[model samples]
Target: MDRKTELKEKRKKIVAGLEETYQKLVEYKRYKKSPLIIAKNGEVLEIAPEEILPTTPYITNS
Candidate 1:
């Protein structure tokens, strides 16, 4: 394989690994029933899944 192709393949593998790790984190958090926390302006905030707003609008047919 060419160097460019090799680099692309390596990047793909790294991305896949990151995705797998993220999934595991999600499962661990769910099992522990812990909310995601972040710090902003020297204040800590907890965010649960339900607290997140949807990006897409809901559509309904009359």
Candidate 2:
């Protein structure tokens, strides 16, 4: 295959791998009462018993 085709294929593979890894992250879930802190200057994420990882991100492009 041509270099251009090879580059495209590599890009596709990388995107797929990233997508797969992103999906597997543990923070994608509904939190009934997860602890958090409101800050005056900046937002604060209170530490949970465990890091809140879910199946997906809070928002997704597609």
Candidate 3:
């Protein structure tokens, strides 16, 4: 593989790993009934675990 293709593959792996980690974090928060703290529009907000939507349809590897 060329350098560019190798870099792209590495980036994809990194993104997939990050996404999986995020899902695990969301699951942990839900299990503990904890709030998810996030920043939106320069404001910090605490979202309930029940209100957390954990998945995005951006990367489909299959």
TM values, all candidates: 0.63, 0.44, 0.86
Query: Ranking by TM-score, best first?
Result: 3, 1, 2
Clashing pairs in 3: none
Decoy 1 TM-score against native: 0.63
- Could you give candidate 2's per-residue lDDT for residues 1-62 as a string of tens digits? 99989987897777777767755443332234453333655866564525544433333343
Candidate 1 vs 3: which has more TM-score? 3
lDDT score, residue 48, model 2?
55
Question: How high is the CA lDDT of each candidate model?
Answer: 0.66, 0.54, 0.88
Task: Give the lDDT of residue 61 in candidate 1.
Answer: 42
How far residue 28's Cα lies from its native spot in candidate 3, in Å, is 0.3
Model 3 ranges with Cα > 4 A deviation: 58-62
Answer with 1 or 2, whichever has the higher lDDT: 1
Per-residue alpha-carbon lDDT of model 3 for 20-55, expressed as tens digits? 988999999999999999999999999999999896
Q: Which ten residues in a row have the lowest lDDT in candidate 2?
A: 24-33
Error of model 2, residue 53, in angstroms? 11
Better of 1 and 3 by lDDT: 3
Worst lDDT 10-window in candidate 3: 53-62
